[model samples]
Target: MADMSLGPGLGSSDTCRSAARQAGAPRVLLVIPCFNEEASIGGLLNEIAAIGRGYHTLVVDDGSSDATCTVASCRSPVARLAQNLGIGGAVQTGIKYAARQDFDFCIQIDGDGQHDPRAIEKLLDAYRSHPTNITIGSRFIDHSGFCSTPMRRAGIRLIVLALNGLFTGGRITDPTSGMRLLDRSAIAFFARSYPADFPEPISLAWAMRAGLTVSEVPVEMRARKAGVSSIDGIKSASYMIRVLGYILLARLVRAP
Candidate 1:
């Protein structure tokens, strides 16, 4: 089982109430999945604390062989996985925790610091105004942020074409965006089963197939603050091909 523990000054009834008053928002949990991100985790936690939005933060350490858990524990609660389960497993762990804890919403944020914490408000607002099962933070809609390399952009375009063609849901511009918001229903569905590989694109396809509504809000993303990306260099090409394959396969299978 994954070990769950709260960080100092977090996950308390008093804390939750205080945050609710500050934001006047429902129970929201920020699920951060990290692997060997010790260099950047501390900064990310500090940034969230600075926001002071009352959204509870959970760092799902995906069996990092570093001090990531140690650093994250100093700020927010952590559900440390016993072993590396890739991004999919790590996110599913967080989703399950959110379901059991009865959170109103769960937001997935990467630990490498590419996703901006300030844009979180944009996501929350989108959900509040036009609620959907999933709200994706996209850098392509406005095209104002660091939109990544040309090759990766091309790859994302291909994946988007495939998703729009295969799925009946609305058009998805950035299927590879890591930042997303999930309602209770989406959380429950993903908690039960989330893709373990090429999760971003594949899970989006699965969620759509499962009859969940998805929408996107424009958010600016910066380059990674620290640590090398898992999908870099030649790996980008391989990632694109594999993710495309998974998206097609997901279309063929029954929705989870």
Candidate 2:
């Protein structure tokens, strides 16, 4: 209702990363959106550390009524929001912080434990190969790991069809995938303006419309170990329609 905002065995990462980034690698920041993810978060933090030494992590607790806030406080600097602003708001907050931190690139990972921290290599590798600003970790490209449920898969396919058929000049295999990496320019763009609802696909179309380089890399993901999906069967159809309307309608009326 109000406006927004990790681990012990982890000492402050600054002491560890200050040396790592001295090798000339761009500073990387991980933005994790959490809502009642207490069951899966603690273990995920451990995995994140294993990704690399220089990577910094920030957990935005979206007004959860559970122990999510307390659990993440020990590991990372948590932005506990005053009220629930949804996942989009949480990510915007993180990106804004990333911009202030002077991060060279930022990656958005899910707290539900659905995204694999290890696949970050492929995302980074893709970034290195192009002048791209956004690299999304796509599940369908390799058809690896869990690709979500049948109903949601159908919805995602429909959205992709629409993107290729009408909007988003170039094709993006998994617009709805939350596992994405953003370079400096993208961090600036997102820090200034981001979609308020269902940001994945809408933001992808918006970025493409704005003429930013966007690419996708194949990745493996796992089924959620805890917490429920934001979209359920009852709302999937309507959710799909709302997102489509937002993307198509918003673009049509923008004053060039």
Candidate 3:
């Protein structure tokens, strides 16, 4: 079994020293964006640990009012935000920490156990082969995994249409996929200033517009094992509008 017993007080300081830093492997940090996902995170951590890929893990606990921090800290390094910084902020916190630690690559994963840790190798492999600044693990590239609902699928299609129109670089199939691989450039950029509330689609579109190489790899993602989605029901419509506006503005912005 993976050692799931990290000590308490990891979040006692501004910086936490909780990773093992195993040698002879690429310096990759798995940045998990967590809210009140106390129930699902432990299994995800264990799955990642079982991969034996020698990845350092950091759980960005976004001011959860539950046992999220406690449970996650026991398995990996925990960055406890004073308040909920939303998905973008929480993800950026982990990326910033990884950048400061000099990790060569950073991979973002959901804390709700939606993404399978086994496919992490596929993402890393695609990065190695293509060498893009960012590699999004796409569900629609192969039309596999949770394809989502009709309305949501149509929304994603519109967003992707905007992305392709905005950037000369090809197209992105799954614009809202949270599972992504970020190289040093992408990591450093996100560490400085990431998107706000709804980040995935906006960031991906913006990165392509900014002349950063972006690509996609095929990966299967599951439904969240626990907790409610932050973007569901009424929130999704608002998310669509916000991300669309961001993409339009990004396209008009200067490249580089």
Candidate 4:
């Protein structure tokens, strides 16, 4: 695990506004957490850069035994972990870095190329329009994107139902979506503590329990461009059962 020492604070509003003026906008960090995604990460980074958003990109290489680090480093700064931590750990690492660097917002994008970079604008627009701590890019809202398999969609629906019942703050249609944008407050909260098991749904529940507001917007997602998913076949069934149990447990526990 990376040592997470808090960096200098955000300082006064005047200073923050000055810095934003210098940078042309508030700093947004694109955190890509990957494991053995060398085949598609480079292209994904290129696509993000081509959008001319001027967002900083950080690739968290989750102890991949392959050349994922090298390939990612060619396009963006790579934070190579010493060992394989699950998706949750990798994402927490990126969030910690974002906190330490005093980024105004952090957006999590899967390295498998399943998330579309073009949808980033939609997420940003939602953030600007609403007072939300987290904005999730959902594929099920519009049903226009490349939704996951039938089995996975069914599992996600079950999880969403559970979350809606347990968390009355807001309705979540895509609890399993990895594509999400977190503001500074949300980033700091997640950096301090995050769910290690079933992070997607569990973290959403935990955030709501912590009194954070959540919202979702329609975004188009693509199928994976390369490499196989970590969960597939029989593993998908196990994933659903385990994630549902975790979400329930998360609801029972008080958020720290």
lDDT by residue for model 1 over 33-122, one digit each (tens)? 999999999999999989988778999999999999999988888877788888998998889878877788999999999999999989
Give the 10-residue window scoring lowest on summed lDDT in candidate 4. Answer: 3-12
Could you tell me every candidate's TM-score relative to the true structure?
Answer: 0.92, 0.90, 0.89, 0.92
Candidate 3, residues 12-110, lDDT tens digits: the string is 232333332343356788999888999999999999999887677888888889999888877888888888778888888878777887778899999
Model 2 quality (TM-score) = 0.90
Give the winner by lDDT. Answer: 1
**Alpha-carbon RMSD to native, per candidate:** 2.6, 3.1, 5.3, 3.7
Residues 74-132, candidate 2, lDDT per residue (tens digit)? 67778888888899888988898888777788999999999988887788888888758
Tens-digit lDDT string for candidate 4 (156-227): 888888899887777899988999999988998999999877898989989998889899999989989998
Per-residue lDDT value at 214 in model 1:
92
Pairwise TM-score winner, candidates 1 and 3: 1
Angstrom error at residue 210, model 4? 0.7
lDDT of each: 0.88, 0.82, 0.81, 0.86
lDDT of 2 at 145: 92
